[model samples]
Target: MSKHLPLRDAVLSWLEYAGSLSPKSHSIVMLMLQPHWEDVVMAVAAVAPRDEHPDLYAKVKGDWMLDHRTLLVESGLAEAAQLIAQGVSVPVSDVADSFVTFCTGQARVPERWLLLNATFPQRTRIALGRHTLQTFTADELRQTVPAPALNGLHPWSLDLDLIAGAPFLHVPDPSRTVTRRPTWFDITGPRAEAQHWQALLPLMLWDNELLRVDSVFTVQHGRRFDLHPPAVPTTIRVYPGSQGREEEVEVRDTGEFHVRPIHLSALTAFCTAITKKIDAITAGLTHTRRVPKLRARRLERAGRHVVAAYQRTYDDYGIWEVEADELYLDYVIALEALLISPDDGKDEGIASRIRSRAAALFLTPTERERTEALVRRAYDARSRYVHGDKIKEQSEHEKLEELRALRLLTLQIILRWLVLTPADTGDLAPLLDAAAQGTGREQHIDRPLHAFFATTSPRSRPADIVLT
Candidate 1:
């Protein structure tokens, strides 16, 4: 029987003999093995100690030696050993140079390996083309890759909560078929919630018919997942009886479905405009004495509604003509609440009061009569809609144009009040009261109401409004 020399014995024999030759030879050998010394120690330690398996220890040791030898061969160190053996008087520098070249030639850690190890839910074995990369836990990945390289490799950590024990692959392997919905890493923080809302806003404003074929439209009011925060308590629902009549769908529910990429541009502008307007109102209120908290609260509530109305209006490009009118009427209602104080004796007087207050605060001297007439016409249309009168007297296109004009007028009025109101006297009620009492001076209106009326003909009026 041939006696097989174990790899550990061969390497140690060469090292001991070489070390005896000179200190330079010892240092060279140590330097060459320094990168993988811990691995070598681990391989040696894995074998059964002489005491535990005294009877079969030599055989166990031989097996471990063969395993370590295979590892060295795979690491490209076997060629370096072969070269060293061929040199009768190999210089230490030559041995070191050969080992360095071998190390450089060895396979590098792939990027996919880093990504999979860092993010894969569990220890999953993935086949990438012909090579199979073994699964690595997150901790193993951190240890395998250098700290700087790891940091550069994975800036965002995997959301374990999202993974939830799901199996994963480093890369899609052609041989294996796995069915699952691709998961997105859950983003946390206040900004993350805001971003999530912003992203969903476009989808929220998208027409249901557009997505009805592609996806199931579910209206969720509360927080459905930990990732989604409590969203605004608004929903886009079709009217119960409006079957196939997308037009019959309430404007408030569907008018805002006209959002496109261009409309997103208005979001920033609207935000800036509202911010500046609120700042102006705040500054004005700061100087006024005896600001009523009840009235201020009402004004703040009205301001929020106004901003919301603007967003709805800006998003109203694709709504049906009648729905557009309904949405514009809704906006007018909110604007009326902001500008006209509640009158106790006559609920019927609200429309008149809205026209009077809007004209005084927003219309120019020349536009006063025309603006009042437009307000009355709009208010009547809103009243009929609220009273369940389906407006069908006029052409639908004409009615839509009329409502668009009303929307423009309402926007102008609210924006003007936002700009003109003094911060000290935050409520529009006081200003309207002062104007009614004939004590306040008429202010110069910068943007004329007529500019908003340009799109609609003077002959056009809300068909639902019965002119008294």
Candidate 2:
């Protein structure tokens, strides 16, 4: 066979390039490969060292070639390509050529012979096609892994534990913050500015639905790329309506240009933190604070009903272990805070402000009445129980039960309000779901959500805008 000059030059160039990309020596050669070429390079690299670059044995060990290939094939890129080709107007020749070139020298492998066998001029011709590779969005990335995309591309998968309760994108700038931006500098950070154009062009070319999967593909070339994706943990300010309705008032652009892989634990942690806070806030609103006395037995029985309702709601949202009594105490504290919030001007009274804001945000006539009636009953029952008053008949227990039901109803209402407020900007609903398996929502929710929040910015004093 004719000597593989292109393959040789490409391999040497790639090794030098890969070394430059990392902060440490002995970096993965395939790291330089772009999403379109990642697998092809990995596969070539896996086999190449066995013969081509025996001198580089200390740098790589490759018994795991099959394992890596399985990862790519499992990504479903091959299948996705088949589907797209049916309707794609692009000719197949362009794709075949891209694939051949990618599989050859650009594969980022250290092995020589493996590289030679993999790169074929004929194969390159066969792989050529006009169709561009498939891509995905950050919102569509999920915890559970779905099947891979066609042509060996796969949506990014992460360990769930990495993201559980961990914050997404670290706020303000989702892209790595390189430096502070001056007002004169229209573009903020380096990556942020680059991604605006990077994400924009691909986004315009693809349908919104396609972006949600957020998969990565690699040609044999050493270039990595993000599929069309929006910034993660998209925060939106919403206006909560009574009856658990949230109307999108504004959405904030996270300024995320590329899809960065995150740990599953981070995703979970974020969910847990927000949910726990919600649970804490809701539980606080449910119970009253009167100490038990001579009528303790009667009060305890009423408390059980309240506890059961609280637990039930928690269970629906995958929360347990929050004891009935603790939840009851929280409910009482929240109720008192809500009642006194309008007058609680104390700087440290954050709970009061939250309550006051909630009251102002959503207390339609019907909802207002419901809240008042429940608070009234809880207050009276608490007073009677604490004062050592005589226990009444069955009617009192019935009244307590009514209060429990109303309390649960109110908690749900409050959560809706809490999630919509700009103060709750970290509540990342759409981005969190992106980590979930399966196809995700069609359009990006971040912009609309941010827009929702921006609407209220005008109401704030100009001095408080926090503009940089």
* Residue pairs in clash, model 1: 281-423, 284-422, 284-423, 284-424, 285-423, 285-424, 288-424
Model 2 spans > 4 angstroms off: 1-12, 15-314, 317-322, 329-332, 341-370, 376-408, 411-468
TM-scores for every candidate against the unseen true structure: 0.36, 0.23
lDDT of candidate 2 vs native?
A: 0.30
**Candidate 1: segments with Cα more than 4 A from true spot:** 1-317, 342-347, 425-427, 433-439, 443-468
**lDDT tens digits by residue: candidate 2, 1-468:** 123334334333432343343233222234335243453444446545435433222332744332333222322323224334343332233333332233333223211000000111111111001111122232222311222112223243332222222212111122222211112122433222122221121221111111111111111112122222231223467798779998874332222222223322332333343344333333433435321121122222233333334323322222233332233344554444322322234676544333333332232445435554555544444555557563234353454455445455444333333334222212222232331212232233323323423432211112212332
Worst 10 residues of 1 by lDDT: 215-224
Per candidate, the number of residue pairs that clash is 7, 98
lDDT (CA) per prediction: 0.38, 0.30
Residues 1-468, candidate 1, lDDT per residue (tens digit)? 012123244334443343333334333444345444444334334443335323212345345232333234322233334334444333434333332222222322222111110112244343323223243444443332211111222223222222232222232223221112111221222221121221222222222211110111111111001111111112355553555554332111222223334433443344344444444443434444444343344445554443333334333333444345566456675666566653333677767777787777643455556678888777777777878886547775576566656655664565456555554544556566566446553532323223322322122222222223
User: Once model 1 is optimally superposed onto the true structure by TM-score, how far is the C-alpha of residue 391 displaced, in angstroms?
Assistant: 2.5
